[model samples]
Target: DSDSKQKKKKKSKASRSDEDYVQSLNSREDRNKSWWDDFRESVEQAEPEGTGKFLFLKLLLNETCEIGDKVLVFSQSLGVLDLIEEMLKIASERGEGLKSSKGFYRPWRKGRDYYRLDGSISGNKRQNDIDAFNDTKKARLFLISTRAGSLGINLFSANRIVLMDASWNPSFDTQAIFRSYRLGQEKEVYVYRLLAHGTMEQKIYGRQITKQALASRVVDSEETGRLF
Candidate 1:
C-alpha cells in the first residue's frame, strides 16, 4: 500500500510538471509573436463593413424603403444574397424607429419586411412568400437569386429593382428587371444596376450591352424577313 501511494504521488507531480511545461510554452509563443503578427491577427478578427457596392445598396434601400416603396434585389450568386441579407439586418437594427418620408419607419423584419428566394427553397414556400409580399403592406424588400427568380415569378408589388451584381448573360438580368415591371404593376418601375469600377463586373456589364445590341439586331432582321 505504501509503495502504491508513493507511485501515485510521483505520477501526480509528473502530471503537474507536464501541465506547467505546456503553459510555459504557450506563454513563450505569445511573447515571441512580432508586432506584424499581432496586426495580422487583429485584421483577421475585425468585422468588415462590407463592399462599397453593398454599402450603396444599403443606402438606396434606406431611401426607398423609407418612402414606402417596395424593392426587388437580384444577384447571380446565392453567397452574395446571403451577404446582403446579413448587411440589411444590420441596417434594419441601426435604423429602428427612424423617421422617414412616410412617417416613422419600422425596423425591417424577416417575413414581414423582406423575403428571400433561392433554389434551395421549396416551390410551395416560394409561392407563399410571393403571395405575402404582394398582399402585405409592410413587405418591402425581396432578396432573390437571379437564376432562381428571373423566370416564372411575378413581383408586381415592387416598383424598384436592384441588380446587385451583373450576370454574364444579359437576358437573365432583363428577366429579373421584368419580374417587377409586369402587366399588373401599376407603378413606374426603376432598375438600378450596381457595378464596381475596377472589376470584372464592369467588363461583364459591357459584354451585356454588346450582347443585347446583337440580340436586338438579330430579332429585327428576323421580323423583316417574316414581313418580306
Candidate 2:
C-alpha cells in the first residue's frame, strides 16, 4: 500500500509538470510566425540591410565574397535549416547564379551556391556536400544542423560561422563553433550566435550561460569527485 501511494504521488507530480511544459511550448509556438518572418526578411533583404540575420547576409555578400571566404551556418532544428535553405533558394532564383568556375560541376545553379547537411541527409551525400563546400569556390555556404554537424567533421575552410540559433547546452553550440574555428584554420574565425529579441530564445540563451558556469564550477572543484 505504501509503495502504491508513493508511485501515485510521483506520477501525479510528473503529470502536472508535463502539463505545464506543454503549455509553455504551446505559448512559444504561438509567437513563431513573426519570428520566422523577421528571419526570412533579414536573409532575403538586399545589401546594406539592418540588424539580425540581415547583418550576416550583408557580411556574406560583402566580406566573404570579396575575400573568397566560406561560411558555415548552424541551426539545431531541422525545420529551421529547411527554412534557411528555402530562403537561399529564393535568393538564387533572383539571378544570383553561381559564380563562374572551370571544370567544377555545379549541381543546382541557384544564385549563391550552397549545400545542406542534417539528420535527413545520407552519409555519402553528406560527405559529397562537405567535399563540394571545401573544394569549390562556387559553393559559398554550408547549412548544417547543430547536432548533426557537432562532431567527426572538420570544416576549416569556412572562417565565418553563423549560429542560427543557440542550444540549451552551450557545449553543443561550442562544438558547432569549433568546426570552423579549429586548427588548420588560417584566418581569424568569426562566430555569430543569433537570438530573437524579446523571445524565449533570449531566455534560453541566458539559462545556457548559467548552466555552463555551474558545470564549469562543478568540474573544476576538488569536491566534484567526492560529490559524485
Candidate 3:
C-alpha cells in the first residue's frame, strides 16, 4: 500500500511538471514587444501577412470582382467573421467598389455588391440575403458562418468558395463546398482551403483527409459487394 501511494504521488508530480513546462514554452515571446502590446498593435494595424489567408482573400476578391464572379467565405468563429467584415469595410472605403452601412453588420449595405449571413440572421432574412447574392450580378462577395451555411443553403451564384479556417470534422468542410455546387450551378466551382503551414490547422487538415479516405474506402467496398 505504501508503494502504491508513492507511485501515485510520483505520477501526479510528473503531470504537474509537464504542465509547467508547456506553460513556460507557451509564455516565451518570440517578439520583442509584450503579448498584449503586440495584440493591440495588430488590431490597430490590421496588416495581413503576405502569405496569410487575409491577403489571399483580398487578391481573390479583387480578381473575382474583375471577372464579375461571386465568392463565399466561410469561417467557424464569429470573431473571425467580424474581422473579415472589418477588412471588407476598410477595403470598401479605399474605393474598392464595396460599401458598408453605418450600423449593424447584418444586411450590410455595400452598393449591392456584398452580403453577409450568420447565425444571427433569421430564416427569412437569410433567404433574402441569399437571394440578393444569387439574383443580382452586383453582389460579388458573401461572408458566412461555417456552421450556419454548411447545411441546406444553396449558394450556386458564387462559383468560388473560400474556407478561411479548417474544421476537425471533414464533413463540415465538404458540406460548405457543396453548397456552391447546387442543382442550378452551371459553372465550374473552385474551392480554396486556407491553412497555415506548420501549425495546428495543418494537423487538423491531415486528420480530415485521413477520415475522408477511410470513409471513402468503406463506401467503395459496400458498393463493390452489392455489384457482385
The lDDT leader among the candidates is: 1
Structural similarity to truth (TM-score) of each candidate: 0.73, 0.66, 0.73
Give a tens-digit lDDT track for model 1, residues 51-122. 567767777877886777899999876656666666766655766422367666566678878899876567
Q: List the residue pairs that clash in candidate 1.
A: none
Q: Report how far off residue 31 is in candidate 2 (Å).
A: 14
- Cα distance off (Å), candidate 2, residue 150: 1.2
TM-score of 2: 0.66
Where does candidate 2 stray beyond 4 Å? 1-51, 96-112, 219-228
RMSD of each: 16.1, 9.7, 11.6
For model 1, the superposed segments whose C-alpha errors exceed 4 Å read 1-49, 95-105, 221-228
- Answer with 1 or 2, whichever has the higher lDDT: 1
lDDT of 1 at 167: 85
Question: Looking at candidate 3, what is the lDDT of residue 111?
Answer: 38
Compared with the true structure, all predictions reach lDDT values of 0.75, 0.67, 0.72
Candidate 3 per-residue lDDT, tens place, 1-228, comes to: 999999998777546412333322333333224455644565456543233788888878777766667899998766566667677766655565342233212233553767777655667988888888899977888888777778888989889999988999999899999999889999989999898889998888888877777888886763212210
